[model samples]
Target chain A: MAVLNMVSALNQAFGGEMERDPSVVVLGEDVGRDGGVFRVTEGLLDRFGADRVVDTPLAEMAIAGMAVGMALNGLRPVAEIQFMGFSYLTLSTMISHASRMRNRTRSGMHVPMVMRMPYGAGVKALEHHSESMEALFVQVPGLKVVVPSTPREAKGLLISSIRDPDPVVFLEPTRSYRLMKEEVEEESFTIPLGEARQVREGDDITVVGWGAMMPLIEKAVGSVGKKGIECDVLDLRTLSPMDSTAVLSSVRKTGRCVIVQEAPRNCGVAAELIARINEGALLSLEAPVERVTAPDIVVPLPQGEGHYYITPGRIENAIERVANF
Target chain B: MLIDDYDPLKKRMLQVLDQEGKVVNPSLEPVLDPDVLMRAYRTMVLARQIDDKAVILQRQGRLGAYPPNRGQEAASLGPAMAIGKDDWLVWAFRELAGLLWKGLDPLRLYLYWMGNEEGSHYPPGLKVLPAVIPVGSQLPIAVGMAYASMIRREGTVTLSYCGDGATSAGDFHEALNSAGTFRTPNVFVIQNNQWAISMPRNRQTAAPTLAQKAVAYGFPGIMVDGNDVLAMYMATQEAVGRARRGEGPTLIEAYTYRMGNHTTSDDAKKYRLEEELKEWEKRDPLVRLKAYLMNRGMLDERQEETILGEAKEETERIVVEAERFPRPTVDDVFKHTYAQMPRTLTEQLERCRRLEGGGR
Candidate 1:
C-alpha cells in the first residue's frame, strides 16, 4: 500500500493495466512527452515507449474518435480530453459511434475504450477548464459513466473502466486530484462499476453524491452529526448504471433523502437520482428529496465561481431541511 | 509515384481511361488480373442494379430512405478492390459499390435501409464498418485503426471514404491531421460527388482541390478521374502499397459527380441543371468500364446482357431475403446494449415485457 493522491492513483492504474495488457495504450495531446497538462501521465512515455504512450495532435474529436478505432481494432485505448468543457467536441463520436458501436453492430463489435477528462470547479482555472457536466454523458445510452471520489476509488474504478467491455466516460474530479491523500493499493485492484460505496452510515437522512461532491457531503454530514441529525452518505462511484439499489435501500431506511451535485440544477444527475428514489422508495419517504446544486447558469469564471460553486454549507442546509421535514 | 505525378496542388488529375473508354494515359493504366477485372466489373454492375432497385423499392414503400450510388460506382469499387482482404474499410454511407466489393451481403445493405439494426451485424471476417450517416465521422476512426495497426506492427491499412461535403466537416480535418501526425497507414478517399444535398463543390471550400487538403496535413494527396476505374484502381493500389510499406497515409480525391439525388428524399432537379446531369451521364463509370472491357474483347454484348440479368435476379432475391428477415425482438433491443446487461437494463427490459402483455 502507498499514500497517493487521485492523480497518482489514476496513473498507477494506467501503469498497472498497461503492464498487464500489451493491448493497452495511452493517447492524447501532451500525454507522451509533457506527461499530460496535469502531469498525471508523467513518466509513462519513458516507461512504455512512444508506441504505447502516444501524444496526439490537439484535437478532442479525433482523440475520442481515434480511441474508438483503436478499441475496434483490439486495443484498449485510454484517451484524455484536456478538460470537460473541451469534451463536447468528442460528443460527436461518443454519441454517434463509440456509445452505439456494440448496439449498432448487435455484438459484432464493441469499443473497449476509456475517455478520461478532469471535471468540476474549485481551483481558480481558466475558462472551459472547470465543468461538472456528468449529466450530459449520463444521458447518452450505451455509455458507462464513472466518477471516483478518493485515491482508492480512483485507482480501482479506473482499472475496472479500462477492463470494461464497452466504452466508458471516466470523469475525474479536478479539484480532488491532489486535495487529499489516502493509502491506496499499489497493486491492481478493481471496484466494480455500478456499485455504490457507503461512506458514513446513519439513520436520520440519506445523503447521496459523487466525485468532488463527496468530501463536501462528508463534511456536511460531520457538521450535522453534532446536532443529532445522523446521515447515511452514499458515494455514487458510477453515474450511468448508478447503484440505485444502495440509494433506495438507504432511503427506505432513512425515509428522507438529500442529493448533492456540482452541476447546474436543471436536468442534472441529482434530478435523475430523485426520480429513481421516487420510483423505488417513494412510499418509504418521510420527507421530500432536497437537491443541492449549482444554479442553472454558465459556470462562472474563476473570479465569480464562489457564488456558483456548490459548498458544504449548501449540502448541510439540504441535509438539515430533509432531516427536519 | 502516382501521387507525385498528379500533384493536387498542380490541379493535375490522373486519368487512365477517358470518358469515351479510350486509354487516355496508357502508361498509367493498371494491368489487372482477368478474374479481378471481371469481379470488379460484376460488383459495379450489381451495385448499379441494386441502387436502381433500392430507389424503386423506396418509391413503392417497401424500403426506407436510401442513398443512390448511380454514377460513382467506380470511385467506390476501385479503391475497395485495391485493398487486401485483411485491410479495413471504414466507409461513409452511399458506398454500396465499395461495400459490395469488400464482401458485404447485399441483403444487409437492403435491411439497413429498411430500418433494421441487424443489418449492421456483419458476418465475421468482413472487415467493413457499418454505414456512417454522419459525414466525415468515420475518418478519425479509420485513423485510429491505422494507428493501432502501426502499434501492433500489423501491415494492414485502413481505407475510409467520405463525400465532397464531408470535407467541410471539422472531423475530416482532424482525422487527416492526426493520420498525418501519426504517419499511420491510412488511405483517405474523398468521393467528390459534387453535391452535398444542394450545396455545390465550389461553395464547400475555397481550396482549388479537395485532394490538396492532404498537403496541409503533411501527406501526399492526388486527384483521380473517378469515372475511370483504371485510374482510381492504379492510384489506390499505389497508395495502399505505400501504406503497407510504412510510407504513411495518402489522400485521393475521386473527382466524380453525383449522377442521382443525394438520397431518395432529395430531388436533383431542384438545384442542379439538366445539362450538368446529362454531361455527367456521358462519363458514367459503368459505361466507361463496360466500354473499356468491350473494346478489349473481354466482354461482349451477350455477356453484358447475361451479367445484367444475373444482377437483376440476385437483387430480386436479396429484396425478398431482406424483407423476410426477422423483426427485432424486445430482447434484441436490450441484449446488445452491454456485454453483460446491468441490473437496471434487465429491470427495464422486464418492464417493457410486462407492458407488452408478456409476463415472461
Candidate 2:
C-alpha cells in the first residue's frame, strides 16, 4: 500500500491501465508534456510514447467528438476536458454522440472512454473553472456519472471507468485533489461503478454525500456523534446508477436522513437521491429528509462565496435536527 | 475533379462537362467506363425520383419530414461511388443518395426518417457511421478515425459529407484544424447547396468561397460543378487516393443548389423566387449526365425510359419493405445505453413495463 493523494492515485490509474491495456491512450490539452493542469495525468507521456499520449488542440468540441471516433476505431481513449466549466462546450458532443453511440448504433459501436475533469468550486479559482455541473451529465440517458472522494476511491473508480464498455463521466473534485492523503493499493484494483461505501456506522440517522462534500460530511457526522447524535455516512461513489438500495436500507434503519452537496438546491444530485429514497422507503422515514445545498445562484467570486459553500456547520446542524426530529 | 489553382479572395468554379454536354478538358480527361458512367447516371436519376416521391409522401402524411437532395445529386452520388468498400462514409442528413450508392438499403434510410432506431443500425464491418443530424458535428469524429488509421498504418481513408451550412459551425472549424494539424487522411465533401434552410450562402459567411477556407487548414481546396456527377466522382477519387497515400486532406466544395424545399417541413417558395428555381432546373444534373450518355451512344431513349422505370419500381418495393418493418421495441430506449443495464436504468425499464402491461 502507498500513502498517496488523489492526483498521484489518478496518475497510477492511468499508468496501470495503459500498461495493462495497450489500446488505452490519453488525449487532452497539455496532458502530454505538462502532465495536466492539475498534474493528475503526470508521467503518462513518459511511460507511453507520443503516439499513445496525444496533445490535442485547444478545442473542447473536437476533443470530445474525437474520442467517439477513436473509440469507434477500436481504441480505448481517456479524454480530459481541462476543467469542469470548460466542459460545457463539450456537452453537445458528449450528449449527442459519445453517450448515444452504443444506443444509436445498437451495439454496433460504443465509446469505451473516460471524460475526467476537475469539478466543483473551491480554492478561489477563476470563472468557468469552478462549475459543479454533475446534474447535467447525469441527465443524459447513456452517460454514467462517477464521483470519487478519496485517493483509494479515485484510483479504483478511475480504473473501472476506463475498463467500462460505455462512456463514463468521471468528475474529479478540484477541492479534493490534494486535500487529503489515504492508503491506496500499489497493485491493480477497481471499485465497482454503481456501488456505495459505508464510511461510518451509526443508528440515529444517515448522512449521505459525495465528491468534495464527502469529507466535510464525514467530519460533520463525527462532530454530531460526540454531541449525542450518532450518524451513518454513506459516500455515494457513483451518482447515476446510484446505490439506491444501500441508501434506502440506511434510511430504513435510521429513520432519518440528511444530504449534503456542493451544487445548487434545485435539480441537484441531492434532489434526485431524496426522490429515489422516498419512492422506495418513504414509510420507513420517521422524519422529513433534510437537504443542505448551496443556494440556487451563480457561485460568486471567492469574496462573496462564503455564503454559498456547504460547510461542516451546515451539515452538522442538518443532521442534528433530522436525528432529533 | 479538375485540380487547378484556388485563390481564396477570388473564388473559382470548375466544370468539365458543360450544360450542353461538352468536355472542358479533354487532354487531362479521366476515361470513363460506360457501365460505370451509366451506373452513376442511374443513381442520380433514382435519387431525384426518391426526393420527388418523399415530397408527395410527406404531403399525404404517410411519412415524417424528409430532406430532399433534388438538385444536389451529383454533389452526393459522385463522391459516394469514388471510394472503396474498405473506406468509411461519415454522413450528414443530406447524404442519403451517397449512402444508397454505397450499398445501404433504401428501406433502412426510410426507416430512420420514419423515426425507427433499427433503421439507423449499419450491420457489422460496413465501416459506415450512422447519419449525424447536428451540423458539422461529425467532422472531428471523422478526423479521429483517420488519426487512428495513421497510427496503426491501416491506410483506411475517410470521406465525410456535410452541407454548406455546416461550414459555419464551430465543430466543423475544429475538425478541419485538427485534420490539418495532424495531416489526417480524410476528405471533406462540402455540398454548397446555396441555402442553409433560409439563410443564403452570402449570409452564411463573409468568405467568398467555402473551398477557400481549407487553405487556412493547410489543405488544397477545389470548387466543382456539383450537378456534374462526373466532376464530383473525379474530385472524390483524387482526394481519396491522396488521403490513402498520407498526402493529407482536401476540401471539395461542390457548388450545387437545393431545387426542392429544404425539408418536407420547409417551404423554399416563401424565400426564393420561381425564376431562380427555373434557372437551376435548366442545369439539372441528371439531364446533363443523360445527354452525355446518349451522345456517347451508351444510352438511347428506350434505355433511358427503362432505367427510370426500374428506378421507380425499386423505390416502391423499398417503400413496401420499409412500411412492413415492425415497430421498434421500447427496450431500444434502454438497451445499448450500457453494456449491462445499470440499476437506475433497470428501474426505469421496470416502471415502463408496469405502465404498458410489459413489452419486449
Q: Write the per-residue lDDT of candidate 1 for residues A151-225, one digit (tens) a residue.
A: 999999999999999999999999999999999988999999999999988999999999999999888889999
Could you give the fnat of all candidates in order? 0.83, 0.76
Local distance difference test scores for all models: 0.93, 0.87
Who wins the DockQ comparison?
1
By summed lDDT, which 10 consecutive residues of candidate 2 chain B come out lowest? Answer: B1-10
- What is the C-alpha lDDT profile of model 2 across B242-303, one tens digit per residue? 89888899899999998988888999988988999999999988888888888788999999
Stretches > 4 Å off in candidate 2: B1-9, B358-360
Q: Give the B-chain TM-score of model 2.
A: 0.96
Candidate 2: RMSD to truth:
1.8
- Which docking class does model 1 fall in? high
lDDT of 1 by residue, B1-360 (tens): 778778899999999998778898688778788778888889999999999999999999999998899999999999998998999999998899989989999999999899989899999788999989988999999999999998888899999999999999999999999999889999999999999999999999999999999989999999999998889999999999999999999999999999989889998899999999999999999999998888888999999999999999999999999999999999999999889998999999999999898565
